[model samples]
Target: MNDHIAPPTAAPAPALQPVRAAGIATMTALALAGLGWAARGVWQIRLAMAGEPASGPPDQGGGVHRPLTSLEDSYHLVTTVSGFAAAVCAIAFLVWTGRVRDNARELSGTRPRYSGLWVYFGWVVPVVNLWFPRGIIADAYRASAPGERLPRSLNVWWGLWLIGMLSGVGLMYGDNTDEIIARAYAHVWQLLASDAAVVGAAVAGIFVVRAVTAVQERHLDEP
Candidate 1:
C-alpha cells in the first residue's frame, strides 16, 4: 500500500514583470526631479517678486529690464529638462499600467472595467480624464487587495494631480502683459499653487505606486 508515489506538485506562479517595476522606479525618480525643478522655479519667482535681484542684475530705470540671468536661466533649463522627463515618465507609466492591468486580470480571472488602451487614453480625453485614470488604478488596487478598503494615497495623488493640471492650464490664459512690472506679478499665485500641487502629487504618487506594486507582487506569490 505504501509503494504508490505522490504526483509532482505544480510550480508557483511567476512574479510580476521586472520591467513594470523598473518603469515605476524610473517614473518615481523623474517625478521627484520634476518636483525639485518646480520648487526651484517657485523659489525664483518668489525672489523676483520680493524686489530682489534673484541671482541677476537689479532692475534699472527706463522700463527696460536686463536679460534674465542665473536664476531665470537655470529655471528655464530645469523647466525644459523636466518637461522632457515628464514625457518619458508618462510613457513609462502607461506601459507599467498595462502590465499591472494584465497581471490583475490574470490573477482575478476576469477583465477589468476599462480596456487596456484606457490606461493611455484615459489621461488625455477631456472631462473623463479627471476620474478615468483614478478609476483604473482603483480597480487594479482592488483586484490586488480583494475586499480591503481602497488606499488613501490614490485619492490624494489624483486630487493633487488634478489641481496641478488645472492650475497649469490656467497659467496659459489670463492677463499676461509684456511690461516688466505686470509680468513680474502676473500669475505668481497660480504658479505657486501649481508648483505646490505638483510637489504634493509626486510625493503621494510614490506611495501609491509602492503600495500597488507590493500588493500585486504578493498576489502573484499566492498559492
Candidate 2:
C-alpha cells in the first residue's frame, strides 16, 4: 500500500475582468456629476451675491413661511438634480473599482488587501472610509503598472475629496441650504473655498481614473 498522502489541489484562479469599457463609462458619469456639482456651486454663489434673504420670521406654532424667490427656488432645484446625479455617479465609480480590483488579482496572482465588499462600503463606513478606497486603488496600481512611480494625482484627488466630504458640500451633510446660505452671507470666502475644493476634487479624480485605467488597459496587451 502507498504510505504517502497526496496534497490537496488548489482552486483555479479567477479570470481577469475587462476594464476598458467600464473605465470609459465611469469617466463619462463622473464628468457629468462633477459638472453638475460645479453648477450647483455657481448657483450658491449667485444666491450669496443676491443676499439669500429669509422669507419671514421663524415658523413659531406652525405659521406659514413665505414662498421661495425664483433664484432661491432655482438653487433648490439645482441642488436636487446635482444630488441625484451624484448618487448615480457613485454607483458607477464603485462598479469600475470592482472590475479593476479583479483584474489586479489576475495580474498579480495575489488577493487584494481589502475584501470585495469594501469596494462599495469603504466610501461610507466611517473611519474605514478614510483609507480603504485609496488603498484599493493604490494596490491595483502597483500590481498593474509595476515600476511606475505612484502618481501625485491620486494623492491630490483623495485629499481634496476628503476636504470636500468631511467639512463641506451635500444636502445630506448637516448644514441645510438656508443655513449654508446664511453662513455664506457671514463668510463668503469660506463658501468659495469649500466649493473650490469640491470642484477641484472632482477634476483631480478624473485624471486619477484615467491614469489608472490607462495603465491597466495597456497591461492587458502584455505577454
Candidate 3:
C-alpha cells in the first residue's frame, strides 16, 4: 500500500503589469522642444556675430534697433523657459525610469543587479553616474528580452546621453571665463554642440523607452 502523496503544484509567477510611459513620452517631447529653443538662441547669437540685423518686427522710428532688441529679449525668454522645462523633464524621466526598473525585475523573476533606489541616484552621483546608469539600463533590457537578443537602442541612447551630459558640463565651465568676447565665441560653439547632442539623445531615448515597454508587455501576455 503506497502512502506517498503527490506534490502540490507550484504557484505561477505574478503577472507583470504594463509600464506606463506617458511621462517618458512627455519628457522626450520637452527635450526636443528645448533643443529647438537652444537652436534659436544659437541662430540669434550667430546673427549678432555676423553684424546682421536679427529678423523680426521693423524699427518704428527713434532710430532704435527694434528687431535686435526683440531678438535679445526673445533669446533670454526662450533660454529661461527651456531650462525650466528641461528640469521638469529630468524629474519626469526619473520617475518613469524607476517604474521601468521595477517592471523589468518583475518580468525576470530575479533580483535586479542594482537596487531600485539606484535608478534615481545613479544619474546624479558624480563619477558613479558615468557608468552606473548605463549598467542598470543594460540589465533592464536583458531582463526584458529574456531569451532574445537585446537591441542596440539601449547602447545608442546611453552613449548619446552621456555625450550630451559631458558637453553640457563643458559649456558650464566655459561660461566661467572672464574674457567677454572669448566667452561669447565659446558659447556659440558650445551651444551648438549641446543642442545637437540633446536632439540625438532625445530621439534615441524614445526608441529605447518604446522597445523596453513593448518587450515587457509581451512577456506579461505570454502564458
Q: Tell me, what's the RMSD of every candidate?
A: 5.7, 5.0, 6.4
Identify the superior model by lDDT, candidate 1 or candidate 2: 2
Residue 24, candidate 1: alpha-carbon lDDT: 67
Total backbone collisions for each predicted model: 0, 0, 0
Model 2: residues with Cα > 4 Å off, grouped in runs: 1-14, 54-64, 169-172
lDDT of 1 by residue, 1-223 (tens): 7669788898656445644465466567747556764754565475456553543333444665677655555555655666566677676667777777777777667889999878989998999899999888788888778998888999998999999888767352342222222334444665666767877887787777777777887765655
Compute the lDDT of residue 191 as modeled in candidate 3: 59
Per-residue lDDT for 59-154 in model 2, tens only? 212544456678767867887888887888788889999989888888889888999999999988999999999999999889888998877889
Worst 10 residues of 3 by lDDT: 176-185
RMSD of 3: 6.4
Candidate 3 stretches greater than 4 Å from native: 1-7, 23-68, 170-187
Ordering by TM-score: 2, 1, 3
Model 2 residue 54 lDDT score: 56
Compared with the true structure, all predictions reach lDDT values of: 0.68, 0.78, 0.65
- Please give the lDDT score at residue 26 for candidate 3: 52
What pairs collide in candidate 1? Answer: none
Residue 209 deviation, candidate 3, in Å? 0.7
